[model samples]
Target: MLALPAESVSEADVIAGILALMRERTGYDFSSYRAQTIRRRIRNRMISVGIHTLTDYLVHLKSVETEALELLDRLTVKVSHFYRNAHTFDMLREEVLPGLYRRFGGPLRIWSVGCARGEEPYTLALLLEAAGIPGTVLATDIDEAALRAARRGIYLRDALRELPESLIGTGLEPVPGDERHVRVRPALRRRVHFQVHDVTGTALPLGTTDFHMISYRNVLIYLQREVQERTLLQMRAVLRDGGCLCLGEAEWPPPSVACSLSPLPQRSRLFEAIAAEPIA
Candidate 1:
């Protein structure tokens, strides 16, 4: 019988060691994620792989490169649907977008950060088409698999449950020879561009400065404080003056950047970027 190393090393230390190994090998850092979330995800991954002990899992993780990838994928939460939060989209369509459309003189440039499986960006695309606004959406996520699916523009029928009735037949069509799935219309797909991006990193895409709106919903709740602050600042830097920043209903900007964002009236999680002060 293999003696359990957890008998000597503390559970927290063992978990930390596993996270450090994941960071070293994958170049994706989960070290700063909420401790409980990280631990739970690690526990789930261990169970999936049939590992029974923390120390044992750490040893196995160190040996298997593929396990590292699996762990990384497990860390990303990809829960999204078309018009996931109806009220938020309702506010966007009714009040927010018209103002932006007027400000930009026609076409708008929007970015959907952490665009899981492409639902959110495609939703934005549908909104633009419905409103007769000529706009482009840049949908980015750190998960390559999610980006691939987003690019494919196909989804199962259940994914459209929250989608408004008016949008039916406008953006998505039933997949032929298959009753269970649908695909975004080609014109709608053309309006949104998908890319793989790491929000925790420093770089923003080229021409990011002119982005009129950025929807960064539901993603920040998983990050550590410092990372959340840094990521908010990055989004702030890329947002054009008076552009909108849409967050998940439960999320708020860290205190450090709160002063630079003003929430829209009667809107649950929408904020407008305050113009930066000029350096003397």
Candidate 2:
């Protein structure tokens, strides 16, 4: 068997070292993440810390306590906003929710996996409330910091600028006297539950839920092919029959899974899930 080239072997070693340290300390296993993305993130961290070599960076990572974890969180790309993608929400409002209502009864259960800072799940809650759909939004992410922010349910006023007029209802209102900060309504916030969850793992605190819909969105793009497959399988296991799975416009599922992808008219990023008949 041929050995990997010297540079390739060295990069792999760095990634392996980082994965080992992260798993041991933070329980975030980036072992199955794509190498290029991981390497880029690590390199960016190194530059930010003024470290020249991977070895030196690893040493710094070891010596630092909470800061190392913060670095990792930053690299995870947690940037998100309410109604980040407008078309997708539009489709959910016009087509998907109605389909779910016709198929299932009231009180829909939605899991927004990797819901960073509560934006996506909160957006869903707002839309559902506007549509008069009785439902609960379970928002989850691996990062505790992000989860904390999500739980606060407070966001910058500008983050909501893109929300459709229908979803926003009246114009944005201040949180009493605070002009720069805005809080989602209590009624909307009441419908959401935020928790820390690592999608790559088997033990999701959420039980075997009959989820009517799931929105993983851009989260899977950070993972490697194998990790994506494993996560998708776990998601499929929890999803109810005939329920839908929504992904980011840039993300695509493996072709082996038998399900129909129906494109919504107004939404480019949204696709509806149709169950394939069992082949006996």
Q: What are the TM-scores, per candidate, against the unseen true structure?
A: 0.92, 0.89
lDDT of 1 by residue, 39-117 (tens): 7888888889988888889989988879988988789989999999898989898888888999876689999999999
- Candidate 2 lDDT over 147-253, as tens digits, reads 88888878888888778766664323468778888877788888889888888887865654878898989988989898898887677777777787888878877
Candidate 2 segments exceeding 4 Å error: 1-9, 169-173, 258-269, 277-280
TM-score: model 1 vs. ground truth:
0.92
Model 2 RMSD, rounded to 1 decimal: 3.9
Candidate-wise lDDT, in order: 0.87, 0.77
Instruction: Spell out the clash pairs found in candidate 2.
Output: none
Tell me, by lDDT, which candidate is best: 1
